[model samples]
Target chain A: MKSMASTSDKILDIAQSLIVAGGYNGFSYADIADAIGIRKASIHHHFPAKAELVAVLVDRYTKQAAAGLQSLREQAASPADQLQLYIDYWRSCIENASQPFCVCAMLASEMQMLPDEVALRVRTHFRNLAAWLTSVLRAGVEQGLFRLDKRPDEQAQMLMASVHGAMLSARALGDPGLFMAIVAPEIARLRDT
Target chain B: MKSMASTSDKILDIAQSLIVAGGYNGFSYADIADAIGIRKASIHHHFPAKAELVAVLVDRYTKQAAAGLQSLREQAASPADQLQLYIDYWRSCIENASQPFCVCAMLASEMQMLPDEVALRVRTHFRNLAAWLTSVLRAGVEQGLFRLDKRPDEQAQMLMASVHGAMLSARALGDPGLFMAIVAPEIARLRDT
Candidate 1:
């Protein structure tokens, strides 16, 4: 049982990275096999189809994102600080090339080709992230820590779009610094009041 | 010769749509063949390789984008109006499901998997766009019609990221309205000053 769980975790990690680096069709089972040094049959045993594997991968990502937000909420003293931490986390990811961009956002750009189940999982992630962002922005607004010309949800959508878009620009321009340069000011603007 | 040119143009059109709908590796020569009612061998005659096909596609897209921005510059009266029309172009694309999202941005997310030539073309598009946007923003600032916290080039990066990012959110959320809802505020903020 322990070995099975570990194998499953390993598979998800590989899939997540592949999806992040490319898109839905960018990597194949053979690619995964080569990377993990495992036979194709073993992968089949874990995930019957590519869709099943991707569906699970997206679900896992959604949960991890939510958990990260939850931990930030618990650890931070203010909503503004929580938002800053979130930006910093993504900034570090972009800078180190540890995770160049958001997997959900990457998948989101390729939504048309994703399996229906996997696509739904990706949408669920955006919704959940938007909700979390709105919650933080709303709290900040009510607490008089942030100013808004629109609703929290609207601001969340804008900020989410900017963050993901900044990653694209940074990767495309081959300049990791561009991500923070684009995003930090926007986050600061939210609290400029 | 004319027919051959027309066929080549048709292939690029279909390939661009497929790339927008999915990513770099999403479509195949067979898919293009099916779309244009041509044989794979014929597609081979035109493109010869997937990388070559995509390279030409990216090049064509870059030119079209540059042309679009150019026309807007000549026709629009003010820098702010030029920016508004730019946002409106993307918003209309998203609303009508025409272009929907920027193909260069889509390809940017899948940069690591792209052929070197194709990836370079994608990067070229970004650089050209940033240059055009910076030009517009600088004109706006000089005209005293807009305000920016960063240099025009940096502001251009933020605005470009936000525009492309909004498209991702709108698509992921299955709501095209989200595009304008997110972008309008940022644009308005620029002109608000």
Candidate 2:
């Protein structure tokens, strides 16, 4: 059972990199087999089909991301700090050339082509992330740490959108600095008391 | 000559829709041929190859978008208004379902898979758009019409990112209302002076 679990994780790591590099439709089991040095039949034995493979990939990504955010929430002193930490995490990811693609961002871009099960997971991830952000923003507003002309939920959506957009802009320009430049003000805006 | 121009435009139209529906590698000449009721040979006759087709598409898209922005700049009374008009144009495009996929957004999502020429064009589009946005934001700040903690260039990038992010969020959720909801406050924030 342990061996099976490890293999599953290995498959997921490969899938994440492939999806990030191309997209949902740009990869196939043969490509994964080549990268992992496994038979196509073995990939099928684990995932059964492309949709199932992506569905599991999305699920795992959302789960890991949620845990990371939860940890930040527990460790950070305030909502504003948590927000900065989140942006900083993305900045580091881009800067290191590791995890250059956000799983949700990649899924969001291929929303139309994704299977319904995969697409639903992507939508759910956004909703949960947005909800958590809304809660944090509301807490900040209550503590007099953040200013807002709108509701927390609305502001949360805006913040998320800006982050994703910055990722796209930065990647397009081939400059991680561009991503930082775009998101820095947003972080500053949240820091503004 | 006019007939050739119209055929080229048709090819672009089909390509854009396919890219939006999938991504850079989503479609082929066969798909475009079927959509436009043309022969595969004809598509090759016009485009020579997939890379050339997308390169021309991106080039033409940037030109038309630039012209649209220039016209908006000439018509608007203030930089803030100009920026708002720019957002409004995207809003209208999304709302009317006229152009559901932003060409740059689509390209950005598949940047890794794109050929060098197409990738260069995508990068140029982003730089041009960001520069235009920076100028508008600078004018607005100078006019005392917008309040921003960061420099205009930085703020503009943030705004651009947020707008694009909102589009992705909205599309992922399959809700146009969500897109507007996310961008409205960012726009309102600029107006808060």
Candidate 3:
């Protein structure tokens, strides 16, 4: 069971990195097989199909995001600071060239090409995160730490869009600092407004 | 000559749509052939290779963007208004489900997966648009129509990122209104800031 779990985990890790570097249609089990030095049939044994593999990947990514958000809630001092910390988290990821892009966000751009199950999971991840953001911002608004011009739900969408778009631009220019330059001002503007 | 030009033009139209619907890897000469009722050989006759096809598509897309920006410059009143016009342009595209996504921006996300020539063109497209945006914002600042918290170049990156990210979110949620809901406020805040 331990060995089986590690194999599946390794598959997911490689799959995610592939999706981040490319898109859904960009990689195959064969690619994964070559990466981890496993046979293609072995990947088929674990995932059975590409859709299943991507669905599982999206689910795992959502859980990871939830855990990160939970940690942010517990550790951060204020809502604005937490928001900055979130931006900073991506900033470091992108700057360090460790994991410069979001898997779900990257997959979301190719939404129409994704399988129904995988696409639904991607949407669910965004919806869940957007809802989480709305709640956080609402809390900030009630506490006088933030001035949200619209409902937290709408503002959350704006912030989410900004972060995702910043990722695209940063990647487009191959400039890590541009991500922070684009995101920090908007975040700072959120409080001022 | 006219017939050849139209054939390549049709090819560009289909290629851009396919790239927008998926990503760089989503479509092939076969897909383009089926869409246009032509043989893959004819596509190769025009493009020679997938990278060449996409290189032409990106160049055409950049030109279209330039024309749009020029029209906005001629028609719009203030620098802030020009920025809003830019948002309105994307909002309408997403809302009306016509050219809902920017091909260059979409391709930019999958930059690592694209050919060197194609990816270079995508990066060039972004750099050109960012420069255009920086100039507009700088003019706005000089005119006192807008207050920028960062350099115009950085702010332009921010605005460009926000727009691209918003497109991804709008597509992810399958909601067009969210595009405007996400973008209008940010543009509004940009002027106020």
Candidate 4:
């Protein structure tokens, strides 16, 4: 049972990296088989289909992200710190070349081409992220840690788009520094406001 | 000569939509042929290879965008108006579902999977765009139409990321209004500052 779980975990890991590097349609089961040194049939035994594989991967990713955000809420003393920590987390990821781009963001780019299940999961991830961001911004506004020209919901969505857009820009330009260059000002603007 | 040019144009148009719908690896000659009522052999004759085809498409898209931006510069009276026009252009695109997304922005999502020729063009599109944005912001600053916390270039990158990122968020959440919701505030902040 443990071995079976490990194989599934390995498949999900590879799928995520593949999805991040390219997109939903970018990689295939053959690519995963090659990376994992397993036969195509073994992967089928676990995932059964590509859409199902990615759907599961997105579900897991969404849960992981939700937990991370929840922990952020606990660990960060203020809403401003929460926002800073969130940006710093992605900053380090891009700088280190580890999980550089958000898998959901990459998948979102190919939203029209994704399977219904996979697409649905991607939407859920964004929805969840937006909600968490809204909460933080709302908290920040309530506590006087942040100022916004828009309502908290609107501000949260704007910040979310800026972060994801920065990721795409950094990846598109092949310059990791581009991420911070694009995002730091956004955080600074919020503080100055 | 005219007929051949039209066929090539049709092929490029179909390929653009397909790439926007999916990614670099999302479609093929067969898909284009099926869409255009032509043979795969014919698409091959026109494009020769997918990389060359998309590379050519990005080039055309860059030219078209540059022309549009140039027109915006001439038509709008000020940098603030230029920025407003830019946002309005994308706003209508999303609202009408005509040219709903930027082709280069979509290709940027699949950058790692793209061929060298195609990837190079995508990067060029971004650099050219960044330059145009920077110029607009610089003009705005000089004219006292806008205030920015960062340098013009940095603020330009931030705005570009926000626009592109808002597109992603709108598409991911299946809400087109989300585009304006996310971007209007960014623009408003610039003006308010």
Candidate 5:
């Protein structure tokens, strides 16, 4: 049972990286096989179909992200601090060449081609992230820590888009600093006095 | 020669849609052939390889976008109006399902998988866009039509990221209005008194 769990985790990790690098159709079972030195049949035992595998991967990613966001809420005392920490986490990831892009964001780029199962999970991620962002912005407004030109939900959506867009720009430009350069102003504008 | 131009245009049109739907690895020569009802050999005759095909497509897309922005500059009297028209153009695209998404933005999602030729063009598109946006923002600031918390170039990057990010959000959520909802605030903040 222990070995099975590790294998499943390993498979998901590799799938996450592969999906981030090239998107939904970018990698295949054979690619995973070569990377892990496992046979195609093993991957099938775990995932059955490519769509099923990706759907499971997205499901796992969404849960992990939600947990991380929950942890952020618990750890940060202020909504502004929470937002800053969230940006810092992604900044470090991009700077270190580790988990540089959001898997769901990458998957979202291929939304039109994703299986319905996979697509639903991707949508859920955006919705959840937006909700988290909305709550944070609302809290910030209530505490007088941030100023908003739009409603909390609207600000959340804008912030969400900017963060994801910053990721895309950083990757495309091959400049990790570009991420902060783009996103810093987003956080700054919220607290602009 | 005229028919040849139309055939090439048709191929680019289909390739753009396919890339927007998926990513770099999403479609193939056979898919293009099937869509255009032409032999794969003919596609090869026009674009030898997928990398070359996409490189040409990005190049063409960049030129068209540049032309459109130039036209926006000519038609709109001020920086704010130019920015508004730019946003409106994308808003209409998302709403009407005409252009739908930026092809370069979509290809950027698969940057790692993209060949150097195609990747180079994608980078060029972004740089050109950032330059155009920077000039507009600078002009707006000088004209007192816009206020900035960051340098014009940085602000351009932020706006560019927000716009692209909004497109991803809109598509993922299957709500075109989400584009404006996310981007409108980015614009609104600049004009905030």
Candidate 6:
């Protein structure tokens, strides 16, 4: 029974990887079963349907990402540092190939194709990240650690868009260094006197 | 014979619209044929396969986009004006709903699912746009119209990435105004001494 539980976990991990590489329609349970050396029936037993599988994946990814952001927030001395830490984390991810593609980014690209539940989850993820970022920027401004002429929410949206755009550029150019190049100045522009 | 040409052109036009709304795999020949008041067999007769249809679409989009950019270059009095003209064109597209989504933006989102030829064409579009923007930035710097701390190529990439990123954000947020808000400041920043 324990082994079966491990197998289910394995299936979810593989599915996330495939989904990040492609979009929702890019793979199927049969592909997951083949990749994991499990029977098609076994995948059905675990996930039941594609929508359910992606919903769970989005849920898991959002939770994990939120926790990660929380940890970053706790570790940084200031909101500016927190923002740097966030961008730096993504830079490392790109440089080390730890996560060649961001899960949220991949899902955002396929927003039109995703089920409503899955799309809602993806939308929630964006809102959560942007809100966290807005708070961080607001704190930075209050503490005189950052400068911005626009509202925190607008700046946060711009920053988020730039980050996602950098990911697409990196993927298109096949060079991770470009990611840092695209993001560094945006971060630098936030430094306050 | 002319009517036959018009029918084929109509299919391509509808196909582009559907593909923009959805991704590459979002629609079918039947959908295009139905929208065009034709038979599925007619679509098949024009393109024979989805891959071929998309390939042709990508090619035509790239060519037309390049021509549009060239026209912007020819009509503008300066490089700065040219860049603003480019942004203004996209802004109008977003505002008037002429083209709410860029073909390359849609294709970039589906790169993982696209065939090699289609993917190459998409990449080429990015490369061409980046190269043109770089040349414009370089000219602006020389003409004392713009100031930048980075190489023209890098800055151009940043600008292009920001534009694409803004599109994703605007689409996800269901607010076309957000697109202008994200990009206008970036353009203003470049014009700032």
Highest DockQ against the true fold, candidate: 1
TM-score of candidate 3 against the unseen true structure? 0.94
Question: Which candidate model has the greater lDDT, 1 or 2?
Answer: 1
Arrange candidates by DockQ, highest first: which order? 1, 5, 4, 3, 2, 6
Q: Model 5 in CAPRI terms: which quality?
A: high
Error of 1 at B122 (Å): 0.5
lDDT, candidate 5, at B66: 95
Runs in model 3 deviating more than 4 A are A1-5, B1-5
- Candidate 3's clash total is 1
Point out where model 2 deviates above 4 Å: A1-5, B1-5
**Candidate 2 residue-wise lDDT at B43:** 90
lDDT tens per residue, model 3, B1-193: 4445598999999998999999889999999999999999999999998889999888888888888898887888888888888888888888888889999888999998888888998999899889889999998989988887788888888778778888899899998887877777767776855
Residue A157 accuracy (lDDT) in model 6: 88
Better of 3 and 5 by TM-score: 5
Candidate 3, B6: how far from true, in Å?
0.7
Number of the candidate with higher lDDT, 4 or 5: 5
Clashing pairs in 1: none
| Candidate 6 lDDT tens digits, A1-193 | 4455587789889988787666677788888989989799999898888888888988988999899999988988999889889988889987886676778667776676678888888888888998999999999999988899789998998898899898888877667898889899887887886
RMSD of each: 2.3, 2.5, 2.6, 2.3, 2.2, 2.8
Interface RMSD of each: 0.7, 1.0, 0.9, 0.8, 0.6, 1.7
Candidate 3 reaches a DockQ of 0.87
Select the stronger candidate by TM-score from 3 and 6.
Answer: 3
lDDT of each: 0.91, 0.85, 0.88, 0.91, 0.91, 0.84
Candidate 2 residue A63 Cα shift, in angstroms, is: 1.2
